[model samples]
Target: MQIQLNTDNNITGSPELLSRIQKVIDHELRHHAASITRVEAHINDTNSAKKGEQDKRCMLEARIAGMKPLSVEHRADTVSLAVSGAASQLARLVDTTLGKANGSEKGGVSIRHLSQNEQEE
Candidate 1:
């Protein structure tokens, strides 16, 4: 994945940045894989369990694998989605913080108690 940083704003990109991103992606992938593995293993472990869920899971896995599934693509997509969500959350936090700071300076809300509020438009 071509990760771009705003180099003009002193946001220089480096190999270390790429490595860190890779690591984060890897960790997220591991979590996803672990969950799927756990589910499949649980189904297998419970020999006398309901066959419906197991069959569904197996079918799901089969369909996914049939789509030329590589664990890497799944991992990358998962990581990208997670990072996007986190960035969105962080942006909201920053906007709220700045807004509250401005408000407090004008004798509105108290800066000391600026916990997460409702999402602003």
Candidate 2:
């Protein structure tokens, strides 16, 4: 994916150059994938969610770099991240509201305590 174009932006007679670049890209991909898998496994075994997130970030960055033409390869990751983030935020909002309602109900208290206390006179 390394654009090996000269100043003229032409790939003319660059077959060998492209082959060499492909080999480098292949090696990087293997290295990145191995590291990513190890990190993922370690993260799965961890109880600390924060640490798991950090590990994920590190692994993703390595994976991105290992991708040839990183700028283009990362588009999928970016879109997925945005979608997941939005969904998570929405879920948190719903959970917070439901939890508060549940807690208030369990407290046995309401806004009309006076009538229930028989002091309406």
Candidate 3:
């Protein structure tokens, strides 16, 4: 999937940082890569120059084929932590959203179908 990184004025979008973020996202969402068309990561420091707990914020938006885009955000003390957290959240969200859309859970029978079978039985 295509990955893009964005940073606010306070934060520098360095090559190393971008690469690290990309790796984290790729690793987290590898299983859903085919369904994902693109991912955009927006990171910024909420406190700017000041130091604070959970000052760094990362927002990840993923575009899935034939579905509306999914987004998740996280905050942490460090950029890496924020990115990782956001990526993890996005992964779970994508799994659930896609699973429902496909009318199956982890490649198994659909819950709705199961309920219908039970009623008939």
TM-score to true structure, per model: 0.26, 0.22, 0.88
lDDT of 2 by residue, 1-121 (tens): 2223121122132556445433433444442333222111001112223333312111111222332211111111222332233223323333343335456543344556566556655
Sort by lDDT, top down from the best: 3, 1, 2
Error of 1 at 112 (Å): 22
Arranged by TM-score with the best first, the candidates are 3, 1, 2
TM-score between candidate 2 and the true structure: 0.22
Weakest 10 consecutive residues, lDDT, candidate 1? 54-63
Candidate 2's displacement at residue 53, Å, is: 21
lDDT of 2: 0.29
lDDT of 2 at 75: 12
- Cα deviation in Å at residue 100, candidate 1? 0.2
Candidate with the greatest TM-score versus the true structure: 3
Worst 10 residues of 3 by lDDT: 105-114
- The local distance difference test score of each candidate is 0.30, 0.29, 0.92
When 1 and 2 are scored with TM-score, the better candidate is: 1
